[model samples]
Target: MEEKVGQLAQIAGVPYESEQSEITGPVAEMGIPRKLLPIAGSVLGVSGAETVKRIQDNYLKENRLGIPLIFMVDVIHGFKTIFPIPLAIGASWDTDLAEESARIAAKEAAVSGVHVTFSPMVDLVRDPRWGRVMETTGEDKYLNERFAESFVRGYQNNNDYSDPYAIAACVKHFAGYGAPEGGRDYNTVDMSERQLREHYLSGYKAGIDEGAELVMTSFNTVDGIPATANKWLLDDVLRKEWGFDGVIITDWASLGETIPHGVAANEKEAAQKGIDATVDMEMMTFTYSNHLEELVEEGSVDEEQVDQAVLRILKLKNKLGLFENPYRTASVSDEGSIVFSEENRQKALEVAENSMVLLKNEQNTLPLVPNEEKIALIGPFGTDENLLGAWSWRGEPNTASQVLESMRKVVNEDNLLYSKGSNIEEITTEQLEEAVQTAEKADTIVLALGEHWEMSGEAASRTNIKLPDAQLQLIKRLSELKKPIVTVLFNGRPLDLNGIEEYSDAILEAWFPGTEGGEAVTNILFGKANPSGKLPMSFPENVGQVPIYYNRFNTGRPYESAPNDKYVSKYLDSSNYPKYDFGYGLSYSDFELSPVQLSKNEMTPGDEITASVTVTNKGERAGKEVVQLYIRDLVGEVVRPLKELKGFKKIHLEAGESEEVTFTVTEDMLRYYHPDQTFRSDAGEFEVFINNSSHTSHTETIVLTNK
Candidate 1:
């Protein structure tokens, strides 16, 4: 591939000695309009297949060194299969489900000619405020490793590109981009080498360990340098330390963002710095065509670098076998056939069924009887087809049924009474009166309201994380109706829901369930499928706890005893406890967890310990429970999280069912990032909890022999 790229470079007649810095502008126009901006050939956005096909036909084919365009998109969660966002999937702790979801996504994405996915974003995010946190698995190296392996397995199936679905996975944000200062998006990240090793970079290593094909650098600068141009991060750490051999893509238009970072004098300089850092792919960003060849001729970018970049790309193309099927999935008919087949919609249903986290149910208010009655479904979002959250590109809003409409599909549509309840953005007196009247005439009210899709992605980050006023007030008003109400929430992050938790009979957290979210919600409501989704981020009571997450080091001055403490990280207005904990979820069926028991409590370095526990379905209905395994590092040189997720298994059982889940604990699963910049676990007493959920982690302590 390198030889091929080299031959192509020679054919282009690019000067071997011209410095990239000396190059000033784009090649003399071939009478093409300078104002016609490029349609993104990479990364998922609104750009359609025809747009990419045009790029392949017009620009790429006529290149001096012809290379076909590789279509890429963000397959962050589940692509078309649309699993819960990475955080929600993380709570499932089901690797098989995670990998299978990715595999389905990869297959569907490939059928559309998308050759690569800027996904399996393995950044270790601890701060909930980072808008992009929804895209990554929760913070913990072991958990991240498990999910990363599943993702790589799903995306890369180790199969040739000719196989129906064979897109390479690109692990993203090369370094500690998740630990931005003040939990602000795109904020500068500064951490000691040891801290970086301990918390953030573990996931990157996990991706590398899984043989990921490509890596995308983060937008934020690590230390002081932008990730796309940081040699220490890209070359010294990623290439030298971990031996990553994949092409590096800049996040969005980060090469140009370097100008904002004040590192580059102009767009050309930023392009040179990024290419000089060996960045091969620029996502949605211009300036590559404007300066790359000129810089190569000026000697700033060596032919070795261009060859290096092209070699990596060609390897991927060859891996995908695009050399033969250049128009893979680009046919107009193929696009028309597989875009949203019934089979795919069923897959979406299965995912939505599994992704719902039953947050709180006071008296099994769920599994609502499929009886014919006057149920007043009152809420601003109840009947909304605005169900499609952010980044939902292809689905037509009217194509799928809304929440109330889906409910009508199962039960008697005539018996189900509906009302607008209130508008999601703002509540008016007329709307309120109509909503209250509807609730007054029903057996129950199903209110659906939450942030719009724009409330949480990119620059849409918010300081206020709660139900929009129109919906909250509507819920309060419906509470006054004295009807049995089930609040179905549609949000991207864990929100403050204490306001209505007491008023509502039940609360269901269904965060942005893709296009078919409404159907999934109704399926669970009508008892067609049980709810098993769980909270992946801590739900702070107020926006004041911006960086809230479940696992964190216990401070020296820990708040103790009283709820209304004056000092020690306590908010004067509210309690420190989050409204919900990480891995927190509820189910119609109840599950009881037994104390964790180790096969051999004490073990030598080479010996393995099997920690096993029993789980019984204490509730009457048959359902699945995610049995969690967590560990606490005792007596460490540096403070460690109160508890870190080590392993989890999702088990299903009938009523009165009991199963023993065994976790094999070896040296690999036991190690943590030490203050010395190496990963190792000091011998001492360890607390192992086999939790029913993240909130209710039941425990047992064991002492090591060497200690």
Candidate 2:
């Protein structure tokens, strides 16, 4: 019983060189039994070939069955060579690049003795106030689902983990984790079952369908029951409905949280609910470790449940090839060559270049002239090398490329002036004056600004989503110089561009472009590479407009179709729309999208209709454009969203070049879960809008019939 229960619980491991040589600190605080450390099924957040080998070697000597400890880490974005955050990856809208980034990340982690990565966080996010929004793809379910599959394929190497370079992928925070109340992390989440099925579950479903080896439960509750203990979600929805035979683990300390969540009275009850809910593993807590053995012996919990959980754990370890060789890819000799290689860094550079979105370019202010222009690079992030953003465990900031250094490679050092405009939080009078003086001498001001790397990961939720007062003041001061300001932002979430946009001539959304961020942004600024990224998440006009997205349902008194003018669903002081809608972006070249052309106006369940659009580059240079296709059911049994993204194609076009892009719309694309819980498309009128962004006036109508 002890061995079975230990396999069902995952505890933190100690570093081989630690002075005490045992799990301490937070683990000690959690009251995990010290005797169970050797028999524990897995270890969390400990890596490196030498350390992993030492821990596993020592554990096997003490264990009876010689079951190896599987190592897991929160390798969300990168292992050593960091890429842009997932939100930035979504902006690129290039699934191939997203896949390549994950492949590179998996190669680095696999060589470091890691078995599983809690990556490709497919939570569909709408509220930027939720600091973890940076960890997701975007608000759209279709976009999230696409990236989810791409990341899984990249991580698992097409789900064939037998290769030494491949590692298992774990899709995380299942079931509406992104829509916490008031955009607060770990807060109570309340929504109808229909809302949950429609908007939230698609990403997780896509990852699971892609053969992800594991799924991590969310911290919040579904229908007022915490997800870790919700039997319907884990057993009925995930197991029975989705047919997910892989392991399901709780988030960090989430199984124990069921007690605080009022679902369980004690650790014993938490253990009972967790196993009954079919959660295969408990992470970072002793709830299952200490109490499960007692529960099974007392006959309160069935022994077969514990045996099934243990079988899943052993199967995963065998899948990782841990039984044949406990140290599968963990080798100190090969670590230096496999991890952080030049080839991997080059891929990081390419991904970063495509991830940055050019938000505003009035009068063609960007793509600055290289040697001819006198440029002033000023701000906290101007010379700061911490562009790796959040969730980078092994990424070294000192090795990162900086904006000032990369700019000097193109322009003469004398032509470029540099200044620390201000700290992230506060600025001195001398600093502001120096920044203005630097800008006065330069022909153009490139202001680099962003939230600190610590500002936006887990537990970093915020109410105000605007730039700090100090950075805003510096923008106000820099505007006094009357120079062309090209603002480069390094934030994680879609921020409220309140005071900065009013002063800047051009704006670039560079969401903490990773290791090669400095060179990538410089290439875009100097016309070496065109900016082709788009906004995956909408930027709100103000913090009050948050929980803002493009695909919202029309209310009975919607502002667009309302009968009464004054009593419509509109904000009193602010506009109901976002400052920048989803899929909104600009590049050096301009591309014009033609009207939607449908093959036929009517189609049956088994029939397919082709929606075609002609995209033409009308500018003088070459560029890439992400042509988006959105559909809307004119009427449904339930209220439908104004529009939902069905498909998109990213195509490259030279000046004066045109491409005819066509998407085949099928009945499966229009299916939805109705009030009766049946998944099917209703026979109705539909509208197809093929454009650059979600906000479009042009559309072509279609009809779905039973025949």
The number of the candidate with the highest lDDT is 2
Clashing pairs in 2: none
Model 1 residue 693 CA deviation in Å: 2.2
Question: What overall lDDT, based on C-alpha atoms, would model 2 receive against the true structure?
Answer: 0.90
lDDT of 1 by residue, 150-266 (tens): 888888885445566767888888878777876678889988878777768878778778888888888888779888889888888888778887878777767778988999988
TM-scores, one per candidate: 0.90, 0.98
Whole-model Cα lDDT of every candidate shown, in order:
0.71, 0.90
Tell me, by TM-score, which candidate is best: 2
Candidate 2 runs further than 4 Å off? 15-27, 561-564
TM-score of 2: 0.98
Give the Cα-based TM-score of candidate 1 against the true structure.
0.90
* Candidate 2 per-residue C-alpha lDDT over 175-226 given as tens digits, one digit per residue, 9 for 90 to 100: 7999999999999988899888988999999999999999999999999999
Model 1 superposed RMSD (Cα): 5.2
